[model samples]
Target: FSEVSWIPNKHYSGIYGLMKLTLTKALPSDLSKVIVLDTDITFATDIAELWGIFRKFTDKQVIGLVENQSDWYLGNLWKNHKPWPALGRGFNTGVILLYLERLRRIGWEQMWRLTAERELMSMLSTSLADQDIFNAFIKQNPVLVHQLPCFWNVQLSDHTRSEQCYTEVSDLKVIHWNSPKKLRVKNKHVEFFRNLYLTFLEYDGNLLRRELFGCPSQASPDSVQLQTALEELDEDDQCYDFRRERLTVHRVHLYFLQYEYTPTEDDTDITLVAQLSMDRLQMLEAICKHWEGPISLALYMSDAEAQQFLRYAQASEVLKNRKNVGYHIVYKEGQFYPVNLVRNVALKNANTPYVFLTDVDFLPMYGLYDYLRKSVVQLDMAHAKKALVVPAFETLRYRLSFPKSKAELLSMLDMGSLYTFRYHVWPKGHAPTNYAKWRTATTPYKVEWEPDFEPYVVVRRDCPEYDQRFVGFGWNKVSHIMELDAQEYDLMVLPNAFMIHMPHAPSFDISKFRSSSSYRNCLNTLKDEFHQDLSRKYGSAALKYLTAQRNM
Candidate 1:
């Protein structure tokens, strides 16, 4: 104990937040090069599994808890801070994976001051002080920062590790959970604050009930007066108000856009019908280069990233309005393995009448919006509950894990589009030049009437909202598809209306997606309902697509 001489710090309003700043200034130059955090981060997953990753991620430099400040917190990306992984933003201050050399050169002291500025930001010190400060440094100086796998700072959030849900745990390198804050706030003992509340209850619980019972429970006027004094206590209590806590739950309005990106003006809010995300941004930009409406981005993100991005997205503008685009953050927090929540989150957050969803990565070489517009004119598109329509295309990269035969590859590059089904869904919003009518217009859509029919495919943010009771990982979505058969919605597949899925690979390959807990949970959750529903909706529909195509 004498060799390490650590002091109990209590100099500022938020001493915990200032730990990073103090460490930056105090570590001896000759001390051990690496400074690992000994946080009592509650264990949620296998620490041993994460320990194995530290060795593999050795090439990576500097890691810590990822923070949500850069996205939505005012104090997080405060006027003085910068963006993440670039110019620096708020970072978790609890534990850091530091190359002390980098810290010294960047004037890490200055970075910490900007984040935890006890002397400068006494009022703002109560929030995101540690995490945001650490990240701010990394964003400001990217060359020094690297993301670690989940093992390091595992308990940063309150959710249990078993409850955690992320797209890939392999991507998580380190975990960080700063000291618990519920018991303490801004260097004040809040546990005692609650104790005071209890004390008030002890003094006046019976009397408080009497006030409503008409002055009968209180033994005397002093008792009634005591109740009044308690009521007024909140005004003077230093415990502070819970409702005023800057952030409680990260609120993100969800949406689904198919191919919704455009390289339009920064103010452009071109809205496309499908759910979209970064994977399809480039393709969307190409498909709807001229869209003048709002563009929806289908966002499927890591739970932590969801918090970070959602916060950032709220303040961001895509054509001016604050809520230009909604985020369908697909997963919940704390579970090392949960996938159903991913689909569930997307299912519930959709705000628009329609949602566009695709696994497209990068921009398309041709405009898909043009083909959709033509199809919409031909098919007579309906709204949310009426029909589900999509365009079909044959490209070298379209199908996941589908290998193109040499002859097919040589002749299939023709860019023209066509439709295998006659319904209208996503019409050309980006690059449309024409409109086409369905051949069987005025005909009644009857697939929904079939007892065996089911939803053709799962669309992110599609209606009737998922029945959450069916969740595990992937089970609920599959059930909804089965339920869709009984609901009477129409479905179709078109050729001319298609856009490239991008980074196309076989959908069945488990290895490509990363073997994380979320992925496993979803796969294991593929129960009877999921399979049957998918079989009715997509199995037959898919068979129809292949059978019909093979004959041609």
Candidate 2:
């Protein structure tokens, strides 16, 4: 983008704006033409009609644009107003049709550069960077531009003075809010256009769909009324059944926040990769404060929750200002947590070479970020098949102040204020961390893998992704750990680094797993199938290892 020579001013100086000049080279060779548009515009007609206008372009015309409707370029509205020179009226880059093939043939790159260089000597700077350079180029070569009608781009800026374009509100084909004030623009017919925008905002998208067609196996009988629908189906075919709902789901918005963090060669920091729903959003401030490193979060939410989250994040003092956090939303059509799916989303988005895959509920010990970085280098785990485990603990007391160092945590452990995570209820989960050994060791110590061991670890980003087949509760995390063992990655405990899980209300899946026998049966079936699949993938040795661990 910096390759384009353009003068920058306060209002319009983003390097991204200069990217428009390089479209011919940026895009593929086969793409002959493209219509670029600004984000702050509303289409009043089908965009296909706008694409049709390209058919009328002459052989010499390489760019199609609508002329500027405002006096910003006219240099008459304000005192000492000086805009970059435009022939009669400057064109808007907001709505552009670039003839890439034609632009390439004319050596468009050199032409734009030369045009900008010639203009900058007379006009020191430009308020509209790309738009100014474009107008200056067209001034020199008038035959290369195809002028679009004013109706095509109905500008609604402050004192646009476009009365010559249209008489009624119905004349607008595309409404470009080309002003800082946006909807509050000083125009005659602002209300009608504002109402049209509001109408689309309040519109219900689901009302447009006639019927669901993707789930081919599921029957959609019109004969079954809404009332007593569940009673009519078999016990195994309930809508709330995990298997049934899971199959009907279609994943959407997989990478909602794309390229939030680009990997750099020198980036050796550990990124905290986690998943959470809207309920745990407040936990972010604490987690980020303690870690002070990059975080990639996968947010599982509905469409409505997504909108609410954006508003919440904006209002949040800590979240809105932070540049280290990347929030990616993954929308699925079911009530299940889809835990592994969410974990994979976070894992894949982490730009750093090392990632500490943990739950959102856990808060790291202070300076764990720097400790992990130092440990990775000291242990030489950057290129080795090793997983550096961070010992996890939990407390029964709800209002305990977080310990800042290893000494304070050990003191609390001696006082029985904190215990190993899920120590009594589910010992197998973090027991493999060997808290007894972790307390005495001052350096990274090797811990043998055990079945169902899922301690939070800082591993390389290329570690096998969580097996997405397991959803809800039960075998989700265990399946991932089992695969790591089969692949022969050693799990070593980091003595200084630790994470403490904050107490929270039990999730719906956990409650179901305890009370509902049917849910347990379904989970057991899934677990057995997962074991068989793992055995087939890693051979009989993997099954023998699991059996040996279970016997112990």
Candidate 3:
């Protein structure tokens, strides 16, 4: 009887038979040579012919194996060994003729020790675990291996066909159904192999039919109930299920804030400021349509980009309906985006007591304005010094129309897709860090101010404005946040409010800008200027604050 205990290989669970190969050391001393074959194969020729191949091996050779026909090993297995020519003849361990005496004499146990090492396994990229380690060892000692003919292992996989095999069907010595077990449903080659295997098993037509389609008696009551439940799931029930599973409720500090007073009608004074580019016209239009109330929009853009935007805005129906939108053109001759300067210009133009600083691509969700108004009234009544900070969300594009309610928006979005400013919040004494934990639900609840995130910030007009010296991408809005934090101002994040950021490419090309010496010089100059100004105002304390704020 050809019997062996099917113990799972520690590294390769799928190829469980590999565990038996490691125990070759326990075999009888007289048994010097043994033919190792995978279970998913059938012999076409006599077993004596395979044993005769041991005569062909050289003195240095300990094993004889056929090369893998698939290109998977060529890319994944041989990635690090790109320049080596030996990689072309990558060996397969499925059908190997092992010389037990030579292996024992050469101390083959060291290879098994390396396989047992967890650190070594973690470093390797190959999915076929044991085979990958074997190939790596063989490559290092190339003279210890002999390549057999492909006919000895006629692989039946997606890439391997009968026509591609080295030998004719009548002359073939072995049929290795390597992938037929998994690929029999979709692949014709695997299907053909499956039929041949069934025929060899002496399965009749009725038995074959029963094997292909499961027998009726095997069906369970649980499966029938599950089918009935699936049949009853309507579109509304599906939408409810999707929302329950996929929607992430971002809980912030404001959700627990006590609201004792109602906002007066006169307290709704907020000017929205955004630095715009030509490509963000759709975003501007969306903001104008969704944001309720007669709030002012102060938009800043480059001279050329502003002219292009004016033409677009005149034609857009969304922009035409809005009566309170204002555009300011800041003249700059070069392609460099003067983001901080543009924002400062917008800040200067704002007439209201409170300003909502945000990008053109962001818009407040429904009922946020009412919530903000109430919060502002409560804050004013309590005499609390704070800036309103709202978390930002990216929209999922499944729905055609803008979301009218939070419930509808939650249904459309995947909870896993929720992302916000990561480096904004910091621990009690630590410097600002972009820790991954800060962005998730595990974020610690503290009443302290969050620094360096300003995508959507509602601040008092009297607060420290944006530093005008900073240019392009890096540390543009961050300087303002740092200054506020250093001054002991509270940056309160509103839990109930979230602004949806419309999908668009970043305004500045970071890769192109980072390479430019002028961009680097501009950033360094701004940093020096900030250091000088803060040093003059706060003395040695400024350096300590700046160091922590800059993550130094």
| lDDT leader | 2
Give TM-scores for every candidate, taking all chains together and pairing residue i with residue i.
0.33, 0.81, 0.44
Write candidate 3's Cα lDDT for 140-255 as tens digits.
67788888888888777665433556435566787786763443534455566566665554422223233555545766886677656656656464233322211211111111
User: For residues 309-332, could you state the per-residue lDDT of candidate 2 as single tens digits?
Assistant: 877877887776777788888764
Residue-level lDDT tens digits of model 1 in 1-552 = 221123223333345544555554568875424545544433334445544433443434544343332233333424764322323223444445555655576576655555444322433333344444455555655655555533444333332222232334454443333336532434222243345333432342223333555523537876566556556545543322211121112233455222233343322111343334333333443334333333444354444454445444444444224233334544322222223334345435434333443323423224443444444434544333433334223333344332133223223433333222212322222111111332222232323222222223323234565544332222333345445543545554443333333444433223523555644444434343344554476655434323422453
Using TM-score as the measure, the top candidate is: 2
Better of 1 and 2 by lDDT: 2
Q: What is the C-alpha lDDT of each candidate?
A: 0.39, 0.80, 0.59
What is the alpha-carbon lDDT for the whole of candidate 3? 0.59
Candidate 1 structure lDDT:
0.39
How big is the RMSD of model 1? 22.7
Residue 216 deviation, candidate 3, in Å?
99
